[model samples]
Target chain A: AQSVAQPEDQVNVAEGNPLTVKCTYSVSGNPYLFWYVQYPNRGLQFLLKYITGDNLVKGSYGFEAEFNKSQTSFHLKKPSALVSDSALYFCAVENGNKLVFGAGTILRVKS
Target chain B: EAGVVQSPRYKIIEKKQPVAFWCNPISGHNTLYWYLQNLGQGPELLIRYENEEAVDDSQLPKDRFSAERLKGVDSTLKIQPAELGDSAVYLCASSFGSGAYNEQFFGPGTRLTVL
Candidate 1:
């Protein structure tokens, strides 16, 4: 079955340090990978996506992700963590007409 | 664009009661979706619509949940005889089309609580 996995339930990083949220997916064909962030009491906000071409895709709030086809991984990364970046992040893969999502990873950036 | 819109940000009711949630996708978006999200978990797709047709609804619990997109513009999801286990956040999202590259835009969502 097609699915996405976020191994870490939560990740902690000190402010100004780089952070990484790991994600891996399994699908039949090419995967359309995406990253989304959800704040407390709010709906999900689109972060970035990897459709084709460049492996490194930049998005809102200084977030970027690297898509590895061989590894079947699309890990979200930020060069510098901010306290405001603390929130729930989700990784999703679009297959055909439906989107399969990973459980979620909570990122905590301490000041 | 106005982005996706959902009504009744919060609702509380007893089990077995009927409830409905409404959603209006961004103008000109041909694809719409309904998702169920439990606390601390990622959202799961309940149904997906292409224009006025429901191309995918296999994830939806037909016994209690039903959805309709009459004109391919606005949509309504109904749950009859809701169970306590059904308490969750119902999210609505839309995109330009069902293409793999098109990004989906989400709404604030309706938080349901079953007593």
Candidate 2:
């Protein structure tokens, strides 16, 4: 079965500081990874995805993720965090047409 | 372009009561999905529709949960005799096609609370 794991339950970072949310996956074949952000009371918003070519994929809200094949990890990163950037981040893997998601990591950006 | 739309943004029902949520996917989207998201957890696929056909429903709890996407444009998910465990955000998503890499657009989920 294809699955995703987000190691951290929560990540706290100060405003303007860099942030990273770790994600790893286990799949039978090559993986198609995605990152989504959910704000309070809202559905998830797509951030970025790593499908085929680029190992380093850039996404919305100044976010990027590096897909490491060896480690089976795709960690979301941002150069500078904004208070508005705080939200629940989810990493997902595509298995066929279904997407298996991670538990999610709550990102808190303190000003 | 309008995104996926879900009705009854919030609902509170007593345990064992019945509830239903509705969703309308984006125009021209042929694939629709229903997901259940528990608190502090990621969304889990409950059902998926390709056009008017239910292509995937393995994860859906057939005993208490039922869903339909008639005409392949709008869908509805219903839970009969709802339980407290069923209280969660029900998300609806749609994509242009039923491909592995097609990006899905999600709606602001319907939050359900079973008292």
Candidate 3:
């Protein structure tokens, strides 16, 4: 079955340090990967997407993700973490008409 | 363009009571989706609509959950005789099309609490 996996349940990082949220996927065809962030009491906000071309995709809130074909991973990254960037992040892979999302990873950036 | 709109940011009800959540997709968007999100989990697609036709609903619990996208615009998701397990955030999202390239925009969602 097609699925997305966020290996980490929660990742804690210092505010000024670089952070990485790992994600891997198992899909049939070419993968269409995406990242979304959800804040407390709010709906998910689109972060970035990897449809075709360009392994490095940048998105809102200074976030970027590197899409690796051989590794089957699309890991979210930020050069410098901010306290405000702490939230629940989800990795999703498009499966035909539906999107299969990972369980989600809680990112906590402590100042 | 205005983002997808959902009504009743929060709702509380007894387990056996019925509840409905409304969603208005972004103007001109031909596809709408309803998702169920549990605490500490990602949103799961409950149903998907292409225009007024339900293209996919395999994940929806037909015994208690039903959804309609009449007129190919606004949508309504209803749960009759709700159960405690049904307590969750009902999220509405829309995109111009259902293709992989189309990014979905989400609404604030309706948080339902079953007592």
Say which candidate scores most in TM-score.
2
Which candidate gets the maximum lDDT versus the true structure? Answer: 2
- For every prediction, compared with the true complex, DockQ reads 0.76, 0.86, 0.75
Q: Which residue pairs come into collision in candidate 2?
A: none
Question: Candidate 1 lDDT (Cα, whole model)?
Answer: 0.93
Model 3 chain B poorest 10 in a row by lDDT? B95-104
Span of 10 residues, lowest total lDDT, candidate 3 chain A? A93-102
lDDT for A45 in candidate 3 is 88
TM-score of 3: 0.97
What order do you get sorting by lDDT, best first? 2, 3, 1
What residue runs in model 3 are displaced by over 4 Å at the alpha carbon? none
Clashes of each: 0, 0, 0
The parts of candidate 1 lying over 4 Å away from their true place are: none
Better structure of 1 and 2 per TM-score: 2
Model 2's CAPRI class is: high
> Which DockQ-derived CAPRI band holds candidate 3?
medium
lDDT of 1 by residue, B13-110 (tens): 99999999999999999999999999878999999999989998999999999999999899999999899999999999999978746888999999
Best by DockQ: 2
For candidate 3, what's the RMSD? Answer: 1.1
